[model samples]
Target: MGLWLPNLEYLNLGSNQLVGSFPMSISNASRLRVLNMSHNYISGSIPDTLGNLRNLEMLNLEANNLTSSGMGFLSSLTNYPALELLSFGDNELISGELPGSLGNLSSTLQIFFAARCNIRGSIPDSVGELINLVSLDLSANNLSGDIPRSLEQLRYLEYFNVSFNRLDGKILDGWSFGNWKNIANLDFSGNNFSGAMPDRICDLNSGLRYLGLNDNQLEGALPLSLINCTDLVILNVAKNRLSDTFPHWLGALPKLRVLVLSSNRFHGSIQDSIATSFFTKLQMLDLSSNAFTGLLPTNFFHNLKALSEVVEYEYDNYRYSVNVTIRGLELPFTITVAIPVFTCIDLSNNGFHGEIPEAVGELSMLLALNLSHNSLTGPIPTSFGDLAALESLDLSFNKLSGSIPSQLTSLTFLEVLRFQNNNLVGHIPRGKQFETFENKSYAGNLDLCGFPLSKECSNGEGSETEKHDQVNGKGMAFIWKVVLMGYGSGLVFGISMAYVVFTTGRPWWLVRMIERDLKEKIRSWIPKKKRN
Candidate 1:
């Protein structure tokens, strides 16, 4: 069998349970152009002899156990002068420093995916040599240190990712950004990059679609230059030190969809300066853990047309994810074919007040909505029944009063409902999702009385009338007691006055005094004529 398939141009044994170290005999296939053995149980060190396949154009051994003892095997890869693609990612045991020889790959190499290989130490600056490389991913590793600036030389590089690593330092400017006019996706999330983000990012070529710089220490106001990037779809700057007001102007971007500014210092009211402004296509809007205040704009919900309509887009083998907080848990949401839809609005832990907007119920496609830990008051809108697709709703730690809407019971998909520590009262609507809700959902509302709560209500008119009669009888009895007390006091006063007159009878002395006074007055009076 040695010479039987010596000219094999392609050998694909992907997704099989294949195992063991690299087959050194493959070197005999001198003309092998493509070899794919990914998604297998392959183990042990990759053989250095694999480098002998000179005309190999693509080598994909990803999702395996290609553990290497040293840098020699990576260095040997330089021999494949025709290699245009290298895929060695997700090999959990492939541990060691990235060899400088990685940069020696043929200039024809256009795509390199070596992520999650558990490789240690900094990326070598020599990676700059792959002038024709289009995509590079090195995420989910323990690698640290500034991304090698020399990567600036890969003018054709479009998709670059170094997320979920311990990489530190500023996302310094001047990394061949000007050359990749066709750059579509760039993710630098989940790292320790600090300092002000370079504003030059807005000056780059225009086809950019996704930009992620979340979970970093970057600060300062959001760059106004972002207005130029009208094609941006997903922009995540959450979990950073950015201290800007709400970026309302971003609403002008016609295609903008996912916008996450949580865990930052974004302040001010969500505005609606332009009726149909920025969020025309937005699917998720998270501004939680900030200083936002005032009523959610009157037209805020009306403008998010995407939230009201059903939007379906495939990730198409790409991981399009955004982190959102649902029911006190931080979860990463990704677009997928199975569920393919997620529209959310999270404005929790701020100063938002007044009634929960009735228009919010218009978001028929919403999956999760949270407005907890705010000063909000008034009734939970009955219109919330319109959120037929809602799975989670949180309105806890607020001043919301009035009865729980019976209309909300129509939300059959609701899995988590929380209204604890609010002023909600009366019966909690029953049936559907309401039946699944626990007592805690209505706790801290003293006026609330229902099946889940300990308080019970009078069911019939006779029972209610009996209660009213009992209260009325008590009130009438108190009023009669006051009247009787007043009548008795008047009788006692009349008797006392009669007794005073009878007890002071000095008749003779009174008569003598009256006669003396009359005589004295008659003697002293005289007419004027008698006096003349």
Candidate 2:
């Protein structure tokens, strides 16, 4: 009776909670072109009868408990002549080496996804036989060993993600990386790729957009050819052994936005005298945990034209990530909400010395700026108040002196401000957001005395008594700025208000009454003048 529908082309019973082993009788539809039983409770080995479906074009058994100790099932699927998309991901597969027969899959295959499959051993060299493949995602597996050079033959491959694995070896100089000219998204992160990045990397893909090689041991200077990939948008090579000056040449890439080179051995001053280009569209620039010195590149920051404009960003379907506090826990900000708020400049843990640049205030869209752990001196830049979007500012552990900029109180969105361990003097700024900060925010700055701190100023220095509070600098500790926090602005205003009311509200006010009473007392003392 099953043979009555021998010409059935589609059989989709997905997500039906169907239990028990995948039935072998499905192959009776000899001309079946699409077979999908994914997201079910199917178990047991795949029957070799599936190979009988010669015309099968799409096979999806993903998100099922499909575990088979046999190795023929993977190879059997190769028998189809029109098979293009094969997805067996998110399944509990039997632990075994991926069969080499997968290399025999039809050349028409384009998308192969086996991520999170408990497949062990090295990736089969025969995988390169799927020459027409476009997207290959075998991530979250225990697959190790170097990628075979034969993969270079896949000229049409577009997206390849082998992240979250133990694979090692240099990505270039071995494989014909030069042949991946059409590849757009390549993620080799979470591996042990070492050695200097190839100098001719740009020769591989002229239109590549996202390149992620982070969490590796890659060393040496950034390939100068990297800037030639003018279409690059996100370049993440963080957590490596890379050592070089700031790759200011990256500014040449017009479409570049997110560039992360954090937790590396990159050294030398970031500022360059002759570079005329600008990272106009850059939103996230992280160079923390390096050896960078000298003042920040004010000229370069001035050219971040995207930052100077009003709040506008291009993160619609895409995502941006940076370290942030999520529910009181430090975590990566990877939310996909419609908020397009993601811009930071991290130069912390470097040897940078000099005043915080006023040019940084030009980035009206910046959300976080970390200039901590440097030798930076001079007062906190008053221009920081212009950053209406700033939420985090770390100016700690510097040689910065002078009073805290009162203008900083204008930062309404500021939630994190660390001025600890600086040489700043004078009373800390008062009012608004300043009042919310605790004593620790101004700790180590002994000269700063204010409400949050226990130290209070001498008496009679309130705003109303400023004229009488003056004393010799050598004879007494002359206080210049009257602390508005301890004595209170409302108290001074109340006294001034009382003075105005008593003097004007009555014809015989306190001043007139006192003068009259004093004159009569003097007349009584002189009796002869009173009798006359």
Task: Give residue 294's lDDT in candidate 1 (0 to 100).
Answer: 90
Residues 296-406, candidate 2: write the lDDT tens digits. Answer: 767878877666665354543322222222211133443111233356777788899977778887777776788888899987776676777666788888899876666
> TM-score for each prediction?
0.81, 0.74
In the predicted model 2, the residue pairs found to clash are none
Candidate 2 residue runs with Cα over 4 Å from true position: 1-55, 60-73, 91-94, 176-178, 310-329, 334-341, 425-443, 447-532
Q: Where does candidate 1 stray beyond 4 Å?
A: 1-4, 103-106, 174-176, 311-319, 327-330, 336-341, 460-532
Per-residue CA lDDT of model 1 for 406-519, tens digit only, reads: 667667667677899998766665676577668887788887777777777646523443354344222211111100111000000111122112223421111221233343
| Highest-scoring model, TM-score | 1
**What TM-score does candidate 2 get on C-alpha atoms?**
0.74
- Give me the displacement of residue 389 in model 2, in angstroms: 1.9
